[model samples]
Target: MLSDLLMLAAAVVAGRDIVVKAVRARTVGIDLLVSVAAVGAVIIGNFWEAAAVTFLFAIGHALEAATLNKTRSALAELVAVAPDTAVVLRDGEQREVPAAQVRMGEIVLVKNGAKVPVDGQVVAGTGAVDEASITGESIPVEKAKSDAVFAGTVSRGGFLQVLATGIGADTTLARIIHRVEEAQDAKARTQTFIDRFSKWYTPGVMMLALVAGLLSGDVVLALTLLVIGCPGALVISIPVAIVAGIGRAARDGILIKGGEYLETSAKISAVAVDKTGTLTEGRPELTDVVVLDPALDRTELLRWAAAAEAGSEHPLARPILDTARAEGVAPVGVPGTVTPVPGKGIVSDVGGRRVLIGNPALLEQYGVTDDAGAAEAARGLAAEGKTPMIVAVGRTVAGVVAVADRVRADAARMVARLHSAGVEKVVMLTGDTRLVAESIGRAAGIDEVRASLLPEDKLDAVSELQREGHTVAMVGDGVNDAPALATADIGVAMGAAGSAVAVETADIALMGDNLLKLPESISLAKRTVNVMRQNISIALITVVLLLGGVFAGGVTMSAGMLVHEASVLVVIVNAMRLMRRTQGSTATPRSRWSPARPREAVDA
Candidate 1:
């Protein structure tokens, strides 16, 4: 084995003409130092010693590659978004072009089977597009003229003529991919440590080798010490561990926004959460309806309101249309023009009468708001944990229907489970109003609530928590949530049921929509960190102990190699434990009391 290794080193030197030049350049790298050690082994007639050094290096390198492949593969999910081609009307001739070259403002002809080329409005045709991959809604949404369409979404049945508004990097899908790349490139604590240590540690070992050679007048002894002090395992261990943790996280459908998450998740003390969307299912449902006009039954009023809202875009419109369709009511014919009031609802003429389906603010603006006598009932429903959207026809209150997205069944149990796993803070962050935020927070066992925030507000909320010297994790799933996700110490994207931008921007992604899985991911990361630290510590300790033994004058090169290999095996086995995550896990909670303000989870 020693003779074979010497031959291999000779072959490498003869094959690489640049090796001599690099050595002459005075840059004594790890490879160069190892090469000198191999030469020294040959001088001492211990050819096996030279071979053992290179063999250990090769094994360390192979293990590093395997671990990186296993851990850094989360970004492969973007391959599914590859758009083949687009049909565009160029100079009145509809021709196909690769999606990469498709430009903004081009009239692209999207057929039933084609994915939308870019983010834009449907200026020419109507079709329902499956935005679930980007929005996690699961249902195909209808899009027509003036309705927004996203790049990479599939057209379900009808052809669409999309006037491309956002193309290339500006498209939503591209934005997500770009963010993911950025996060992956961002440095983590473990990587930073290796970089800082390598700068000074490498040169110090070289100087030590020179001193030893001068004192002993034996180049072989100094070379052996240099080989033993390569720090190869330490350099590779941290990154291998990080990528492994991240890869396992991706397999579970969690996108970690960046390296920062690993650090923050380990340190968070107290947790606060937003109620709606975070603790409860974001989809609103029609729970109850009150009919003010005896002439109009619950079904008729619902049908009219849904028809009016159909032309208007809002999440609450789904429950109305779903209920109306299930009850067999014919929809009011859509009008040519419809106007929406921000706080109120939408107003459109339906069935030849002026229809006003909105809250009091909309009616009051027109000086025709009505009490409708359902306020008291709505308030009672609110206390019982239901959200109510008011509906009125003209100035007279027609009805107030209670709509609520139920709290997730797994929430309370998951919170308790994480607590048991030693996560001191269990938080929920949501964009719902105070009433809605509190209702879900109490039921889900969240420590606190931060409510009524728009996109910027949500980012600020996370920033404030950070300024107070707390590590924070922000989880969300919309375009509006992107900033907060970027700003948080750790941004966990709800991947499987989350928006593309959300997943791409997040430092970590959750493949499972159940919020319970977040604790699971955090646990996995912490374990990986622990294993990597262990691997590094063991390797360094073994090198020190063995090298000291060799200088004490009784150690053989073959025996030293055996000790190094043993340490290497221990490191690899320790890293493997990260594959199994606890049912729920998170950071240790500290005794340092941060203020417990009952702030609502604000929207980003």
Candidate 2:
């Protein structure tokens, strides 16, 4: 009687929630199946079996909950770092207030070891900020006036006065937390299919259990089938993998929009990148100034170029103006009217003379014949990967000035890593001349180049790749790339931490300027998809094995429950693998071009 009472107490304590859910919810689920199985076992006087099954299941439930929380540890850490208070300057005095209470445009003071309380630009002082909370980079970045600082990052040393531009929920950290939570809850395509499968699968299991008992008159067999037929592992298979994968990426500052994006990213075959910012520094510097007319010296040619460019806001204008300023021939008189020719260059009216600086097309548009071989000189500079701008003075060919943007150091490594991650083509799409684009492409190991393209042409280039049966990802940081980004299978925004638009709009947002995160995101998605598949397979196989064993011989209700719980734990453990970073995730891949093997080695 004592033993029976102990068994009854264990069933009540461990199985109460299951019974309540089954009765109160009016829905059939794993809870219902487990409740019915335990009740049946008790009615048949198998008290120990009832006690053992519920107890083991309760233990497994505790373990699963703990392990699942471990998978979300990265996101939890992010949430914990959110700033709670701010030190703001009010009426020339520092005041402490709730972080959210600080008004926009308020001056906030950040001291050493304090969390930056708002996203803003540094207006005074200097410091090294540990932006690891925001960018996932461990090294502290030096901050000064005009440099942007994000909330939730710590000031490693020194002090700073920040002008609050984004506060409270408007900050980057808040956006990241919200995105991660939504991504975790959003279902993948495979998860959706599994959900529909489980809708009928649970009831089918109960029906099979009932029929088996009725045909064979085996009460023990029916109870055992229900205990093992919960579908616990199968239902959680995809979600666990997605949560872990996304959380892992968030830790590394790579934000995937959702599970659907994660799936599509795994299949990316082509990556279309904008050449200006994505591949090169986007800061053009005047490299050469060749005088075509005998009357003009090198300084005279620069005077005309800088005179027109000084009134323009083009990226190429800065380098020319800077070079001229350093040479003591900066344009003293601003142009009366500066007209920008899209995809060509600039036409400016300076001191009552028409000063045209552009490509061959601009010269032709004005019917200016290049008798001085200005076009040929421009071509020679362009072939060397420089953007050559021909200067014309009142229809007279003046000279050719070339500007070049330095290529990023990690660009070639990024391309090699993309190949290692299974991307077949890395294409450069730009409005720069074909020769300049080709030069950049060869240096960066890009497979294709689409140059001299207008913004619309970029959209068409992405479409062309898609039409060729390629799953494309367009990477860029400008408005011109917007159409192509929207049309591609995935839109990746580089250095997205500074732009709210990029953070919200991109399919994959790399918070840091680091080029390596692109391929890391792809490889991670592939690993996550593989883990989901493996989990589903494990769940199905365990169910099949348990079913066969229950009928073939010695599988009791207790044994079936034990095996069912074990399989669920295994799936969770497999998903936990994503939370750990691998060495290859950041390592640069070796050059893809290898020497041909000997004939005997090829045969072998």
Q: Give the best candidate by TM-score.
A: 2
lDDT of 2 by residue, 1-604 (tens): 9999899899889998778888886557888889999999999988899999889888988998899899999889999999899999899898999998999999999999999999999999999998877777777888889989998999999999999999988999989888888888888899999988988999999999999999999998888889888899998889999999999999888889989999999999999998876787666678999999999999999999999998987667888899999999998868999998865677899999998888777888998998998877877777777878889999898998888877778899999999999999999988776777888899999999987777789899999999999999999864878889989999999878857887777999988877888999999999999999999999999999999989897788898899999999999999999999978665322111111100000000
TM-score of each: 0.70, 0.95
Model 1, C-alpha of 459: deviation from truth (Å) = 2.6
- The TM-score that candidate 1 achieves is 0.70
Q: Which residue pairs in candidate 2 have backbone atoms (N, alpha carbon, C) closer than 3 angstroms, thus clashing? A: none
Model 1, span 1-604: residue lDDT tens: 7666666675354323323543765555666666666666766766666666656655554565575554545455554664768889999999999887888899998889788878788898888787644442345777778877778778988988999888777776666555555655666777797778876887888888889989999777787777767666666666656655655554444556566576566665544444545566666677877787666888877876776766765666667778887888747556545777654556776655656665445656676645555556556656656666566665566776667777777779767766764567665565555666677778888777766567788888878888877677776654567677778777666533324544454556653455666667666656766777787898788878877986987666546655665666566556655545444432221111111111111111
Best by lDDT: 2
Deviation of model 1 at 437, angstroms: 2.4
